[model samples]
Target: MAEFTVNATRFDPYKNFKFRVKWDGKYVAGISKVTSLKRTTEVVKHRHGGDPSTSRKSPGRTEFEAVTLSRGVTHDVEFERWANKVWNYGSGLGAETSLKDFRKDIIIEVYNEAGQLAQAYKVFRCWVSEFESLPELDANANAVAIQTIKLENEGWERDYSVAEPTEPSFVEP
Candidate 1:
């Protein structure tokens, strides 16, 4: 008889609770949430002059809503730097609306426990719409400091390749 040895490994469902975010690949930061969607379609109808009115439909322009990404406030001045570069602080509409002030996209890469990419999404033509207000701080309260970043992007698409787990045998989250 020949002797054989065996190794046992446990397979657990993947977790996507933790994730990292990037701002046009320039700055990498922690992300809490990112949500946005295309504008709803408006229904239009056309009626005949004399007889009963016929039905007609038309689709409105494709518009994107503002996306909000919440995260723990960074200790550095990265936020300030980015805002200054993208948004005009001084008076004038020129600063607020300029092609030179917008970023190409914002990417979010979610990883598994093994540091493997679980899912990813890229938001295109993102520009800072709002910095969002900072939460109140109290000496007596015990809580983590968090802030949200609002970005208005034209559109977004998911990275299907990255969304699929790299591991050959892994459970979906």
Candidate 2:
């Protein structure tokens, strides 16, 4: 993302002025009009939306609102892509850790198609060993661990099978 800085000054009609405005890009002289000095000053101040420390909500919210309102469709598409990527990754990882005595906090960093860090989500998986009723290192624990391994392996098989579908139904009958 490009860093945007705002530069504002009194519109001098007599003297030629040139300055780059935020988001609007480069602007040259005679582009902006200054009808009344007092009125223009009032309008500029109003546009600035008063002091930052004031109770009034910050202009950042306005900037976000403007961007979101303008790029609603883009935002939705980006969100869907992000969600799909996260789900695909999670599906792979979820099978591996399920029913095992793994850590509760698993952080997954999701990236956009442009390879930018979009967002992060936490995955919490339950373990049979963590349960009070299950005996430690007993048949039940071993069974659960075996189940987890099977699940993980099965997930990988499913992914590969989907990538190279050999079944008659998948051949488009």
Clashes of each: 0, 0
Q: State the displacement of the C-alpha of residue 99, model 2, in Å, after optimal TM-score superposition.
A: 13
Could you give me the TM-score of model 1 versus the true structure?
0.66
Candidate 2 per-residue lDDT over residues 80-170, each given as its tens digit: 3322332333566555332333322223333333343333332233112211111235654433311110001001001111121121323
Each model's TM-score?
0.66, 0.16
* Number of the predicted model whose lDDT against the real structure is largest: 1
TM-score, structure 2 vs. true: 0.16
Q: By summed lDDT, which 10 consecutive residues of candidate 2 come out lowest?
A: 149-158
Give the alpha-carbon lDDT of every model.
Answer: 0.66, 0.23
For TM-score, the strongest prediction is 1
Error of 1 at 74 (Å): 2.8
